[model samples]
Target: MHAGRDASDTLAALLADWQRARTPYRADAHDELAAVLVLAGSNADVERLNLAARAIRRQAGELTGPDRLYRLPGGRTLALAVGDHVRIRTNDYRARKSKGARADVLNGYRGTVVAIEADRSVIVQWRRPGADGPALATEKVSAVYIAVGGLSHGTAMTVAAAQGLTADRMLVYGMGLDPHTPYAAMTRDRLSAHLYLPRNVLESDADRARHSAPRNGAEELHRALNAYAAILQGDRADQLISPEPEPIAAVRARQREAAEQAEVQKMAQAVFAAAMLETVTDPRRPHGLLGDDQLQERISAAAAQTTALAKVVEVEQRRERQQAEQVTAVRAQVHAELAGERDRLATALTALDDAAHRHDAAQDRLRTAQRKVTALEATLHERYGGRIRGWLPSGERARLTEQLQQAKEKLTCAARRAEAAGRAEQAALRQAVEVFPAAPSAAELHQRLRVLANPRTFASALEKESAARVEAVLPGLADQRRVRAARMASPGLGDSAADRQHRARQALAALTAEADYRHRLDATRQRGEERARRDPAAPALARSRHEQAQQQAETRRRAREQQRGYRPSTPPGITAEGPRQGYGR
Candidate 1:
């Protein structure tokens, strides 16, 4: 067989095998043999055959037309028809370092240009194929070449290169028009250049160099050459040489200026007539000119008028000074009145505070005296039986009983005085509020109210706090009393009557100490309740908080009892001697 026929048979058999198997064909396979078969027939020389094969290889893997055959980079043959399912395989490879410390492939993931990085790599992002929704992924690669077919939106290229690229539309963002980037991103069918100039981008020296006068001159020369060619082709001699006529509108502007000048002259004539009419007919002179004697008389009259005006100005100045003095006196008087009012208000508040302090002191004394009297009575009963009046001879028991009675009476009188003083202080405060109105401060009013208002609530809180303190200390006092009573009962210990009396005195001192504790607790709680009522937005909330504190104290007491392995015999707020009589009212 002939060599050309044998090559043809091999090519034909390879094409049939590629058709049977569904795969894409790559171009670099058997390049020399394919060139021989392609250049075999017709008068096509070797050079033309080489060019044809190069052109065919250039479009090997691209989508050219419907139902066309394409060869991918892998060695396979496949049909690239419409509605064909194509899969792109992405391999994650480690970067290979070059001699210049540059990466040949920074990343291989396919995507659009998300950013142009500082390291001269372009960040590309695109959706993963067959993903749910528009799921995106990014890769950083060299900005020299971009595969734009994979991106959903358009990508941006930083460098300007115009070869081996195709697009439908292009946009230049934050950059001026460069000579090459515009052509690189333009579509062959229809190209529209859209420029977006952000604050970071400005026309630089390189842009001016590409768009200078010499470049514009070259472009104009081309346009002139085209026009001359068109003229030679057309044969119209007069049309090319005719000069354009001057526009009539420009000549029409001078007529308007002339009319404006005429109107100004007419206005001048009218002003001259008005001046002639204002002038008086000078019978002594032929022309309208003033004489030297008349001019001197006019000047003297003007001087007389000026002197009278100066006198009126002096009179006005004197009146203004008197008014200013009156204003100053009125301002000082108002300030003095305000100062006097402030001082008076301060004095009244101080007096009210003093009265309140006296009232509180009187109440404290009365409670203390009452507790003392109660303690003395208990002591008397503990020392003596029903024969208390006859137990002591030297009139000592009678004197002690009389003193207790007097203390009770004094407590009663003190309570009455305290009540009266509280009422008087409250009345004075109300009168001040009515008389002063706006003169008193809110703080002052709040103080007065805490001291003088809601006496019942204050009295109730005081009673409860006092009762709690007494209840807390009562068990210890009762235990001491029990021990003393046991000692008295068991005389077998060989104790004397004086010793028993001394023990009784100690018990009485304990009772006094308990009473003192209760009094001090009441005073502390009273101040807390008063402040709570004065400042808080909700007084009831303050009261509840106080109750919580009381509950917490009770819990701690119970916890101590539990720790000591002793069950509490009495409920909270209840003493062993039962609730104190005449309390909580």
Candidate 2:
């Protein structure tokens, strides 16, 4: 079996065996059709090998009959010669084209091309499907059907297609795809299965030649062999999920259970479900279970159904019209409210703007007054340069002091004006908030309107909707009736007409509560959708004048620093706090 040896080892052994036998691949060597099979991994290799086989036979003058070229599955052309192997690729021949021939030339059936007809249709001696026996039927396949990509050159079949083939010797190439593929390929021979794989192993590594250079051929082969082996044998499955080996008795018991389940299924389908089992109470009824048809009654039923459908369509149209009218009214109200609020907000904002202007003007005047006081202080200091505080003129000091007090008074008046303007701005802002308010979010709006498209079961067609409700409610009623029947256990005492009416009323009450709850949920969602509003205006006035106050204070501090650089500056009490604190406060 070539056990414990790889394809390369087998190939080397094959070469040694061939040399020992001294048999060559000459045209005369296979005169009696040598008992050998050539297999490949791909269609391209198969096509090439098949053509070589055909040419060898032709050179030997064995196949003298004319041949016809036909297309193979993978866009390759194959010439079918007498005594050449061919495999049927489809079951279409059995589908209406041929009768007795159809049954024989099934898919995967290997055959020999016996004759080529004038119309290019070929007569093939076909083997029975899945059989290893010799060809049992000779069928004339249509040229039109043969033109289909269904006929392939089978002289050199792929390892995938060599499953049904068995010969004295088999030579397989380029089929190291998986362990199963090579295993299946190698095991198809009665005598020897020779596999040929490259020794370098780099040849097996697809696209590796472009990107990779092996540091050491031996090392690369060693590494690449492991990966190649993995590709050949995916997911090593040596260990069982149970971790314990199943006993023979347990295995038999599990198989027995499976068999028993199969038998039970067979009984369920085959034995229990006969036509006799489908008997109805009345044998006179048409189709037994299906009740007898009444001519006038059936026609009336159809007419009534059509009228109901017409009513439902009318109801849907009226509902759409009413919803449109309601939406139009609500949208008009929303626009009107939006316009009124926007106008009020604009008026209030304009007032706030005016107040802000007045506040800014008052601040400017206070700053000017403070600057004048600083100038007077600077002039006094310059006029009396290098003078001691006691030597300075009392008249000039009194004059500077009076001017500082006057400036402080003016600042106080400006501060009062600013404070009044701030009050006015605040009043305007409050009025704006009261008039415009914030826009209506879904949560805040008083949503009394609902715009819902309920399901057909609970919508405008009340009568039709009731049919569905009854259908739903009856099952529950039946369950209750069944429970009562079980409790009573009498001859139909629990299922009387009055009792049925009572039970139906209880079901109706429950349905009414549930329907009401659903309506409330739908209404809530619909109202939320209906409560849309436009964005509101939020214009803010520049109310706080503290930034200007800080600037003025900094300006005054710089002025005092300049005055100090010259001579005795004015008194700190009058320059720093007298006018500044009056307005800054």
Best by lDDT: 2
- lDDT (10s digit) by residue, model 1, range 1-585: 011112222222222222222122233221111111211111111222222222222223222233333332322222222212222123334234335343222222222233554544445444433346544444554423323222111112232322333322333221233334433433321333332222111223343355443244345334333333333344324335454344644454445435533533343333222222222121211121223344345445545544555565567557546544654554455445434544555566667777778878888988898898988788667655467544566465677688889988988888898898888677657655653574365366555445333566544544454444444544353354456577679866545334544444454444344334334544533333234334334334434545776788899999998878854454346569977434221
TM-score of each: 0.21, 0.30
Model 1 residue 523 CA deviation (Å) reads 99
Residue 337 local lDDT, model 2: 52
lDDT of 1: 0.40
Top-TM-score candidate index: 2
Off by over 4 Å in 1: 1-234, 238-343, 385-394, 436-585
Which digits, one per residue and each the tens of the lDDT, describe model 2 over residues 84-192? Answer: 7677876655536554445546776666778887888888776443467443567778766777766776656788776776777777664334566877887887777
Q: Model-by-model lDDT, in order?
A: 0.40, 0.52
What TM value does model 1 have?
Answer: 0.21
